[model samples]
Target chain A: MKLLNKILFGSLSAIFLLSGYDGFSQAPDKGSLSVAINYFNDNNKIPYVLVRVKTKVNGKFKTVPGIPLKLFLNKDSAGLLIGKVVTNESGEATSFIPPSLKKEWSATIKHSFHASFMGNTKYDSTSADLTVGKAKILIDTVGRSVVATVLELKDTSWTPVKGVDVMLAVKRLGADLNINETATFATDSTGKASGDFKRDTIPGDLKGNITLVAKVVDNDQFGNLSIEKTVHWGSKFVSKANDFNERTLFATRAKAPVWLLFIALGIIIAVWTVLILLVQNILRIKKLGQEA
Target chain B: MKNSKSIASDEQIIQDLLPRKFKTSGRIWVSLLIAICLVGIYAYYRQLRYGLAVTNMRDYVSWGIYISNFVFFVAISLVGSLITAVFRLAGVKWGAPLTRIAEMIAVAAIIFASIIIIVDMGSPERFYNLFIYGRIQSPIIWDVIVITTYFFISILLLYYPLLPDIKILLRFKEKSGPGLHKFYSFLGSFWTGSHKQYLLSKKAIYALCVAIIPVAFTIHTVTSWLFATTYRPGWDSTNFGAYFIAGAFLVGAGSVVVAMYIFRTWYHLEKYITPDHFDKMGRVLVLLCLLYLYFNVNEFLTPFFKMKESEAGYLNDMFSGSFAPVFWFAIFTGILLPIIILLFKQGRKPLPMFIVGIMVVVGAWFKRYLIVTPTLLHPFMPMHDVPEMYHHYFPSWEEWAITSGSLAGAMLIITLLCRIFPIVPIQETINEHHETAK
Candidate 1:
C-alpha cells in the first residue's frame, strides 16, 4: 500500500508538471518528416525537380501537404536557389531550373539538387538530395523505323551512352501506350536502339498529330530523361462545329428545337387563352351578379 | 320558393351541410395532425440547416422518400380530376355531391406535391434558375409547367363551384365566426346567383372540366416521363406513362372511397353520401386496380420472361431477392387482394371499402418507394467499390418526419377546408330535396 501510494503520487506530480505550462494544457510536439526528391526533364527541355514530404500518422505514413520546400542547385547551404514551392495534395512540390542559373548549368558535366523543408509547429525539419550526370535522348523517324540515341556529357564533350535501356511509347492521356511488342530496348555499343513504326490507328487531334516519346526510367546517373516528338501517323479526328446560335434540344432557351418550341408554345398559348377566357367569364359573372 | 314545395327540408339540408365547429375528437384529430406537421416542419428546419446530408440519400439513391412522396401526392391529386371533371362531364348526377370533396382533396394533395418537390432540391433558393434557364426539352421543366397549370386549374375548379355555397354560408353569420364570416364574404359577396351570372359560371365550369382532363393526363404522364426519360432498368420502359396513369387512378379512387366513408360517418350524412356511393366507388376501385394490375403484368412479365442481361438483376430483386418481401407486399395488397376483396359485394360496404382503401394507399406508398430505390440500387453499373452503407438505403428520421409533415400538412389543408366549407355541395342537396318533394 505504501509503495502504491508513492507510485500514484509520482504519476500525478508528473502530469501536473507536464500540463502546468498553460493551465492544464501543453503545446503538442511535432512529428518528424521524411523527404524524397526526384528529377524530371520533359519535352519542356528545362530540368525540374519535385519533392515529397511525408510523416507517420496514426501508425501509417501519410503525405503532408502545404509544406514549403526550397529547391537549390549544387551546394547545400550556399547554393543557387532554383525556385520555391509549396506541397500540393500529394505532398509533392515541383520547381523548374531557373534561367538565372544558365551559366552555372552549362559549367557542369554533372549536377546536384538539394530540397529542404523548414521546421513548422506541425512537422520537424527535413532535407533530401540527388546527384545526376547530364544526359539527353534523341528520337527520330527513319524510313518506317523509329530510332533513339542516348548521349551523356563526359568532361565537356558529348559521349555515347552505351547499354542504357530505352522505352519507345506513344503518349496518351493517362499513361503512354507501348510502341512495339518489345517496347524496351538496350543501346548497343553505338548508343542507338531501333524499333519498327508498328502502332497505328491511334486517334489524335484535328491535324492527326500524335506525340511519340523515347524515355529512360530512373537511372543511377541520368535520373529521369525523356524527349517527345509529334508525328502524323495517327487517325485524323474531325471536330464538330459548335455554333452558339444553333437550335437543338440541348441549346439555350431561344435556341430550342423549333418544332418543339412551336408545339409547346402552341399548347401554352391555347391553354392560357382558354384559361383567360374562363377568368374573363368569372369577371362577367361578378358583373352580372352586381347588376342583379 | 324557387321550385321547392317545403322549406323545412331545405333548412335541414342546410343545417346538416353547413360547416360545423370541431367536436372534441375532431379537435384532437386536428391537433394530432398539427403536431405531426409541426414535427415535419422541424425536420425541414434541420434539413435546411444542415443540408440534404441529414437524409439517407447518397449518390446511389439520390431520389429518396421525398421524391416518392411527391409522386404519391401527384398520384392522389389525380383523383380530383377523375371525380370532378370526368364524372361531371359524363353527366353523372350522383357525382355532384362528391365533386367538392374530391376537389378539396386534389387541391390539398397538389399543394403538398409542389412543396415536397421543392424540399427535394438541394438549393431551394435557386428554384428560380429553373424558370430562367429552363430547357424546354427537359421533361423536368415540362413537369413544372404542367403541374403549375394543374394547380391553377384546380384552384379555379374548386372556386367556381363554391360561389353559391359561399352565398349560403354567408346567410349564417352567427354559426361561422366573425373571422370566417368576413372570409366567406370576401370570397362570395358579389355572388347573387343571377341567371346571367349562372350562365357565365356554367360556361367557365364546363371549359375547366374540358381543360382539366387533358391537363390531368399530361400532368401525371409528364411526371411518368421524368422517370421514363431516364435509362434505368425499371424506368426505361415504354409502358411507364400508362402504367403510372393506371396506378394514379387506382390510388385516387381508393382515397376518395376512404374520404367518403369518413365524411358519411362523421357528419351523419347517411341520407346524402349513401351506401350506394361506397358500392359504386368500390366497383370503380376494383376496375382501376385491375387496370393497374394489367399494366403491372405488362411492366414486369416481359422483362421477367426475356431476362435481358441489363434487366435481370432488377427483375430478380423484385421477384425473390432482397426486395422480394416489399415487392410481393405491394403487389398483393395494392393490386391483387384489392381486386379479390372488392370483387365481392360485401367488400363494397362503407367500412370494408375504407379498410381496403387504406390498404391500397399504404401499399401504393411503398410501391412508389420500390419503384424509385430498387432500380437505383440495381443500376446498370453496380454499386461496387463503395462503402457498405451506400449499398443500402433506409429513410433517416428527418426524411420520415418531413415526409410525414408534408402528408399531415396536406391533410390539415383538407381538414381546414372541411371545417370552413361544406364537404358536400349544399346547393346540390337543396336541389335534390326539391326534386324529391316534387
Candidate 2:
C-alpha cells in the first residue's frame, strides 16, 4: 500500500505539471497585418493615387495572400462604408474607382479613402487612410458648339487633366428639364473637349431659350463634373401679321388678330355710344322744368 | 285688392320711405366695417412690401380666396339685372319694390369686384397694362368690357328710378339734414316731375330694360368663359356657361333676399316689403336652386361616369378624398338644403328664409373656394420641386384678412347707399299701390 501511494502521488504531480505546460503552449499566436495602397499602373507612380490594396504579414514581412479588406470613404460630414476585396495571388487587390463615387465625391475637395481589416483571433485589426485631390470642371458655349474643360485644382492653381472622358448634352428648359441630345468626347492634353448639335434640331421655350449641359465623368484623376448654359438658339415664332386662327387665340404671347380687334372695338364702341347717349339724356333731364 | 282710396297718402308714403340718418346700431356696423377695412389695408401693405409671397399662393395654387371673392361679387351683382331688367321686361309687379335694393347690391358688389381683382394682381401699379397691352382675344379683356358696360347700366338703372323720389325728398328739406338736402338737390333738383319729363324718363327706362337683358347674360356667360377656357378637369366643359349663369342667379337672388330682410327690419318698412315679398323671393330662390342643382348634376355626374384619366383624380378628391368635406358641405348646404327649406310654406317666412338665404350665400362663398383651389391642386402634371406645404393649401391670415376686408367694403358701400337713398323706393311704391288699387 505504501508503494502504490508513492506511485499515485508521483503520477498526479507529473500530470499537474504537464497541464501547466499545455496552457503555456496554447497562448494565442501574435501575427501582424499591414496594408499599403498604391496607384494600379505598370509604373506604380506615386502621389497620383489609384486604387491598389496590398497586405504583408509574418516576421519576415513577406506578402500574404487571400486576406479580405474593406474600403471606406471618409469625409468631414459623413463616411461611406463599401464592399470587401480579397487579395489576389500576388497579395494585391486592384479596382477602378466607381463612377457614382466620382460624382458624389465632387463636393469634397480632398476625399480621404480608408482600408481596414477586422482581424480574426490570430491577427490584430489595422486601418489606413489615403487622401486624393478633386478635379474642377468649366463649361462654355461658342456658337452652336459646347466646350468643357477639366482641370485639377491644387492649392490655388489649375492644371489640365488629360484623356478625361466628357459628355455634352442639350436639354429642354421647361418643368421636366428633359434631355434632347447627348454625345461623348474625350479630353486632349489641354483638358479641353468640344461637341456641336444643330440649333434647329434643339427645341426651346416660346421666347427661344435653350439649355446646353457639359459633363466629365468617370475619370481617375478628375471625377465627375458638370456645367450648364442657357442661350437663345432655337426656333423663333412665326409671323402672325396675316394669320387669324385658333392658335392666335391660344398663343401665350399677345398678337391680337384683326377680327378680334374689330369685335372688341365694335363692342366697346357700341357700349360707349349707348353710355354717351344715356349721359346726354340724363343731362337733358335738367332741362325738364324749362320745358314745362 | 284694396282700393286706391285705402292706400296711404303720397305724403305719408314719403314720410315712411324717404332716406333717413343711421341709428346707433348703424353707426356701430359702419365702424366695425371700417375697422375691418383698416386691418385689410395693413395686410395688403404687408403683401405689397413682400410681394404675393406673403399669401399662401405659390406657383401651383396661384389663384386663391381673392379670386373666389371676386367671382362671388360678380355673381351677386347679377341680381340687379334680374330684378330691374328681367322682371320689369316681364311686367312683374311684385319686383318693383325690390329693384332698388337689387341695384344697390349690384353696384356695391361690382365696384368691389373690380377692386378685388386689382388686389389679386401681383402688381397693381401696372393696371394700365390691361389697356395698353391688353389682348382683346383674352377672356379677361372680355370680362373687363362686360363688367364696365354692366356697371354703367346698373348706375343708370339705380339713378333713373330715383328721380321722382329725389324730388319728393326735396320737398321735405327739414327731414333731410342740410348736407343730405344739398346732396339730393345736386342729384335731382332739375326734376320738375312734369308729364313730359315723366314720359321721356319712362321711355328711357323702357329702352334700358330692353338692352340690359342681353348684357346681363353676356356678363355671366363671359365670366364662365374665363374658367371654361382652361383645360382643367372641373372647368373644361361645354356646360359651364349655363351652369355659371344658374348659380349666379341663385346666389344673386339669395343676396337680394338677405338685403330685403335687413332693410325691412332696420328701416321698419315691413309694410312696404311685405311677407308676400319674402314668400315670392323664397319661391324664386327655390326655383333657382333647383335649376342650379340640375346644372351641378350635369357638371359632376356625367363627368364621373366618363371618369377620364385626367379628371378621375380631381373628381375623386372632390367626392371621397381630401376635399370631400368642403365639397359635400357646399353641395348640401348651398343647393340641396336651401331647396328643401324653401319648398315649405313655413320656410318661406321672413325669418326662416333669411336663415336659408344666409346658408346659400355662405355656402356659395365656400363653393367658389372649392371650385378654384382643388382644380389647381389636381393639375395635369404632378406637383413636384415645390415646398411640401404647397402640396396642400389653407388660406393664410393675410388672405383671410384681405378677403374679409373686401367683403366688408362691399357691405360698407351698401350700408352708406341705404342711408342715403330710400331702400324701398318711395315714389315707385306709391305709384305701384295706386295702380294696384285702380
Candidate 3:
C-alpha cells in the first residue's frame, strides 16, 4: 500500500513539474522557430508535404506543437499563399499542392516554399524557406514489360535525370488485394529507369482499364512526382465505342424498340390504307348517288 | 329572312347562296395577305443565307416560336374533324350550314402547319433525309405519317362535300364567268345529283366521319407525345395527351366561331346561320373551354402540389417567376374569361362570341409558346457553359416575320377558298328546307 501511494504521489508531482517547466519556457524572448518540410511518396508523386515547426531553446531544437503555420509558394514575380494549417500534437502540419501548379514549373525544377508562424502573442513571428526539386515521369510499354523514365523538363528541352529511384504501381478498382506490384529501380546514365511487370500480376477496372503510375518520390533534387496512364490491358476494344449499341433505346444514340417500331409502322400503314379506301369510295359517290 | 323563306325553290336557293365576288375590303385584305407573305419570304431568304443563328435559339432553347406556331396551326386544324366528322356522326342537323366554314379553316390551317414545320427545320434541304433516314421510332416520323394522312383526309373532306355545291354553281353558266366556270366544271363536272351519286357521297362521308375520329385523336396525341417523350419537367406527364387534345378542340371550335361570325356578317348568312346557331355554338365553346380547363388543372395542379425536385423550377417560373405573366394571361384570357363570358345567353350573341373566339385563339397561341419554351429553359441538368443569351430565349425579328407571314398565308387560303366556293352549301340548305316544309 505504501508503494502504491508513493507511485501515485510521484505521478502528481511529475505533472506539476511539467506544468511549471512549460510556464518558464514560454516566458523566454530569445527563442527561434524553424520549419522543416518532408514528403512521403506512395506512387512516385507526393500527395502532400509535411511541415514541422521547431524552437531553439537553450541552443537545442524542440518541436513546438499546436502552432499555426502559413504555407506560400514563391513565383518569379510574386508569392501566393497556398494554405494555412495548424501544427498537430507531433508539431507537424501538411498542405496539398495540386498538379496544376506544375504549369508554373520553370527549367530550374526548383520550387521555393515558405512556412511562417504568426497570430500568436507568446512567440515572436518566424519564417523558413524550403527548396524542392521535381522531376517529370514518362512511361512506355515494351512487349510484356514496362519502362519508367524520369526526366527533368527544362526550357525547350528534356534533360534525362540519372541515379534517381523510380517506382511502378498498378491500381485496380474494388480490389482488396494487399499484394504489392510496385517495382523499384534506379535510372541509368541515360536517365531512363526500366522495370518489368507480368500481365497476370496486373489488375484492372470493370472496363479492363489498368491505371499504371510511375513515381519518383525521394530525390535530393526532385522532391516527389508521379504520372498515371490508363491503358486497355484486357479489354477487346481499344475505346468505349463498342461498349453500347446505337440501336438501343437508352443509349446516347437512342433508337426505338422493335415492338414500338412495328406498332408505329402498323398504325401508319393501316391509316394510309383506310384513307386510300376513303378516296376510292368518294370517287364512286357520283355513280352510287345516281342509282340511289 | 325573306330570302331564307323564298329558298323554298331550288333555283332561288342557288341565287341566295352562290359564290359572290369580293368587295373593296376583301381586295384590301388580299393585298395585305400578299404583302405579309412577301415579307416572310424575304426574311426566310435571310435565314437560309445565314443559319439558325439568325434566330435567338441556342443549344438550350433549340425550338422557338416556329414550333409554337406549328402547334397552333395543328390545333386549329382539328376543327374540321370536330364540326364535320363529330357533328355529322352525331346526326346534329344544325352543323350543316357550318361544315364548309370549318373545313375551310381546317384545310388552310393544315397547309400552314406543314409549311411552318418545314420553316422550323434548321436545314429545310435535309427535309428529304427525314424520309430517307427516318427511323420509325422517332415521334417526328410518326408526325410526318399522321400529318400527311390528316392532310389528305382533310382535303377529301373539303372536296366531297363541295361536289353537290359545285354542281349547283355550274348551273349558273353565265353568272360565273368563263374562268370560274372552267374551274368549277373541272372540279365537279362529274358530280351528277343522281340518287346513286347522293347515296355514294353520303356513305363516303359516313365512312370518313367514323374514320376521322380516331385519326383526329392520334394526330393530337402524337403531337403531345413529341413533348411527353422528353424528360423536361413541364412536358413529362401522362396527362399531356388529353391536355393537348382538349386544348386543340377548344381552339379549333373558337376559330370556327370566329369564321362563322365573319361569314354570317359579310355574306348575309344571318338568314341561314341564325342567333340560335350562335347560341348553340357558344354553348359548345363553353363546354370545350371547361373541359380543357379540367385537363389543364390535371396537367399543372398535381405537379404543383408535389413540386418534384426537377419540376420545381419550371413550375415556379410558370406560377410566379418570369413566365408567370404569360402563364396567367393564357389561362385567364384563353380559358377562364371565355368560359365566364360564354356562360351567359347575352354573351352568346354573335358579336360577343366573335370577340371571345378571337381572345381564345390569340391566348392559345401564346399558351403554345409557354408549353415549348419554358420547359426547354428548365432542362434536367443545370444551365451551364453556355452564353448568357442561351439561358433565356426570345424570338428574333426573323422569327416574328416568318410567323406572321405563315398566318397571313393561312388567311389567304381561307379567303381564296371562300372566293372560289359558296361559303354555305346551297343544295344542303334547300334539301333541309324541303324536309322541314314537308
**Which candidate tops TM-score?**
1
Count steric clashes of candidate 1: 0
lDDT of 1: 0.89
Compared with the true structure, all predictions reach lDDT values of: 0.89, 0.81, 0.82
Off by over 4 Å in 1: A1-136, A139-147, A151-212, A216-225, A228-237, A241-245, A252-254, B1-9, B306-317, B382-387, B432-438
lDDT of 3 by residue, A1-292 (tens): 9999999999999998898676455565545677787654344554467898887777888888889878777632224666678998778888886555555544355677777776466677887766766556788777646677877666657788888887766654653221145457788978887666655534356677777767776567766677666676644424456536655554431466767767777877887787788777766764464455
TM-score of each: 0.79, 0.69, 0.72
Best by lDDT: 1
lDDT of 2 at B257: 93
Worst 10 residues of 2 chain B by lDDT: B1-10
DockQ list for all candidates: 0.52, 0.29, 0.22
Provide C-alpha RMSD values for all models, in order. Answer: 6.4, 14.7, 16.8
> Cα lDDT of model 2 overall?
0.81
Q: What does candidate 2's lDDT look like per residue over B1-438, in tens digits?
A: 223345578777778888878789989999999999999999999999998999999877888898889889999999998988899989887888899999999999999999999999978999898888777778998898899898888899899999999988888788888899999999998899888788878888887787777788888889888889988889998998899888989999999999999899998877777888899999999999999999999999998999999989999999999999999999999999999999899999999999999999998998889889999888888766888888788888999999999999999999999888999888887887777766
For candidate 1, write residues A1-292 as lDDT tens digits: 9999999999999988887667656678889999988888875388988788889988999998999988899966545998889999999888889999999999988899998878888888888899999988888898767788889989977788888988988899999988878869888887897788677788888888899889888888887889888999888987668876788887878788889989998999999899888888777877877787
